[model samples]
Target: MRQGRRTGTTALLVGPAAAFFLLLLVLPLAVVVIYSFGERGAAGGYSPAFTFDNYLSLATRGQAFLNTLLLAPLGTLLCALVAFPLAYFLAVKTSPRWRTMLLVLIIVPFWASQLLRIYAWLLILGNRGIPSLLDLLGMDGVRLINTRFAVLLGMVYGYLPLMVFPIYVSLEKLDKRLLEASADLGAGAWGTFRQVTLPMSIAGVATGSLLVFILLMGEFIIPALLGGGKVFFIGNALVDLFLQSRNWPFGAAIAVSMVAIMLATIALYMRFMLGRSGLRQQALV
Candidate 1:
């Protein structure tokens, strides 16, 4: 009787959360999946008939998919490269007094809306901005805005904070004695950092990379504003499909595909990270 009561209490605690998950996440996803296999109406919105045409027609948006696949990883990598040194400086180099102030500086940009930040980039990269300055230096017709480079620049700028904080936390949690031990054992600065510091802080790097990659994969706003509708991504394609074209079935199909791709990508990434982590553990042992 007591065990039965305990079971009931546990169920009572879990029930609301389970219901919320089912009602919100699971229900909407189910609806989208069902709609993905359906047909579009004559005017707009979804129709009841089931068909494979929507998924089959996904090839039409191949360019957008290609662009997303290419840029997202590239941007993530760039963000990681830029963030690592900054994160290292914060976590290792700076005194505790200065570190807090510098971190605040990094975070201050996020207090403003992302749209406003990108708009600022837009002005800086526009014709009469950087290009005009370049023209004075005899590099006339230099264009920075509305290109793949502009999109990449915005991506790195916007996502830098996301990349930094995770890495900083990871490095902060590192045991300092390990470095001291390495030095006492006659390991030089480079060797100490390579074997001790890097391995200890890799979790941060992995976390930051994954966070940046996932966000970049679904990024629409930066590309839209910076690319000027020229450098398209899957997010842009979905926006156009659902909102502008009102092709719900097709949009749902693309959304489903994007989710699948992201899942597979993340799984592979995790596996790789785990394998590397295992190797690092064995090496340390």
Candidate 2:
């Protein structure tokens, strides 16, 4: 009887949360799916008319899709490139005393809002900031703000901490003896890193890359602020559709498509990671 009561209480506690999620998340997603197939009303909201025109309209935002697809991956790669070495140094080389300090420093910027940090970048990269310094060096006025480079730089800066912590944890928990064993077997430093260190840290790299890439796909602010409304992305398209154009049906279609693409990317990343895991096990054997 007591066990029955306990189970009943647990179910009561979980029921509200499950229902809340179903109502708040699943129900809205279902609406989106339904609306994606339905036609826009003459007055501009969802209508009873069923059609695939919304899906077909996806091609209209091809440039945004292409830009997001290209830049998100490139930005993720750049973040990884910059983050890995710092993570490696902090995790493998730094003393315990300094490791915490260094890691804390990496994350300290996060204490401030990301929007604020990006705004700060505006000051540094603006006409009066870096351009003035360049003028002093006899360099011509360089347009830094409102460019793809600025967007990429902001992405790398914003996401660096997210990348570093994961890789650092993975490296810190790594078996140093394995690395020493590889070196003892006549492998060079790079060989040992490639064979031992890099392989083990694959999980972290995959995780961090996925996290950054998914967020980047949905990102609009940095590009909007730094690219000066010129750099278009799927996220920007969604924002424009909802806010400026107020085309919810088409926006929902685009959003659904973005979700589909994200799922596909995650699925592929998981498969690749699983294959790598199998290879690592085989190599160990």
Candidate 3:
């Protein structure tokens, strides 16, 4: 009787949370999945009939898919390049007195809306901004805004902090005595870092890379604002289908495809990461 009461109490505690999770996350995903396999009504939105027409419509957005596929990884790579060095400097090099201030500076931008920050980038990179400044110095016709470069730049800037904090935490937790021991064994700075530091911080690198990659794949706003609609992503295509074209079935199909692709990509990425870690361990041994 007592054990039965305990089981009931545990269920009572977990029931609401499970219900909320299903309602918020599972329900929406289920709805999208169901909508994807259905037909769009003549008046827009989902119709009762099941069909493959919506999935077939993806070919129409080929260019958008290609662009998103190519650039999202590029953006993620760029973010890692910028973030890792900055994170290392902050975590490994900076004095405690200055580190706090620098970290705060890095994080201060989050208090503002992302929309507002993207708009700010618009002014800073536009024709009258960086271009005009360059022209004054005899470097004329420097177009920065609305280009692929601008889109990549905005993505890097927007997500750099997210990329940094994880790596920073990893680096911060590193055992400095390990470095000292390596140096005593005549290992050069580069050797010590390559064998010890890099291996140790691989987790952070993978975390940041995955975070940036997955988010970039679904990015629409950066492309819309910085690409100026010229360099459209699949996300932008989905937006148009659902909102502008009112093709709910097609939009749901696109959404489901994106989710499936992301899941597959992340799984492969993890497998590669795990294999790499095992190889590094073998090499060290």
Candidate 4:
């Protein structure tokens, strides 16, 4: 039948992508789960024995877990705060030609390697950089490099583009007539924005925040490079466990725990956002 031929063709088109997904993503996750329940070999790899000791050992890295939980949300909040205004202006205020140019400028940094960007930040924020300028200004002993502040700055700069684009897309797709309607109903600028503009852009804000938060949760490079091995996060702990200590089982346990925590956090956050929106809708009506 023609239907049979069409189905065969569809499968043929999708077969390689499906195979790659299973082979690369699903299989590696399955291996990690299997290794998490196994014993660590004497020679520094997984051994064929069932045990929960690895999961229990996670408590030893509690400080790393605490540090990550603190820093990740802080970075996500700052990213959202800085990006929203920039995105709104670009989407709502700027001329089309200038908007295109500015958006491109925002994304241009992403084309280069993230590592190279962070390394550039190191020199700019180092003793020979910002501190040198401060010294000339009579503010001696000012430090920027290898501190928590440097880590925060690096994370915000690195993740700003990811945060901005989603919000810009949302604001761009917004209905402008609603603002006119709000104004016709005697609403002031702030009132119109609060009742119409902000509500409509909630989807974009939620999407951008979730995207930034999820990535920040797994981020290791910013803390490692900017924090200069002085700051400890679960990501750094995982790297040490797998590469330095050769503790595969414990590393798998940490990864699995991180996945579980992120899923739970995201679910709760979505519920809160949806509930708040529902309440706002009722109030508006």
The top-ranked prediction according to TM-score is 2
Residue pairs with backbone overlap in model 2: none
- Local distance difference test scores for all models: 0.90, 0.86, 0.87, 0.88
- Tens-place lDDT per residue, model 4, 184-251, is 99999999989888888887888888888988898899888888877667889989989988889889
Tens-digit lDDT track of model 1 for 38-83:
8888997899878999999999999889889999999999999999
Best first by lDDT, ranked: 1, 4, 3, 2
lDDT per residue for candidate 2 within 108-188, as digits (tens), equals: 999999898999898899998898899899997798998889989999999999998888878888988998899999999
Best of the two (1, 2) by TM-score: 2
CA error at residue 110 for candidate 1, angstroms: 1.1
Provide the lowest-lDDT 10-residue window in model 1: 276-285
Pairs with steric clashes in candidate 4: none
**How high is each candidate's TM-score?**
0.91, 0.92, 0.91, 0.90
The TM-score of predicted model 2 comes to 0.92
CA lDDT, candidate 2, residue 242: 73
- In model 4, state the lDDT of residue 46: 84
Two-way TM-score contest, 2 vs 3, winner? 2
Cα lDDT of model 3 by residue, 162-258, tens digit:
8998788888888989989999999999999899888888788888888889889999889999899788898998889888888888889888988
Report the number of the highest-lDDT candidate. 1
Alpha carbon lDDT of residue 179, candidate 4? 83
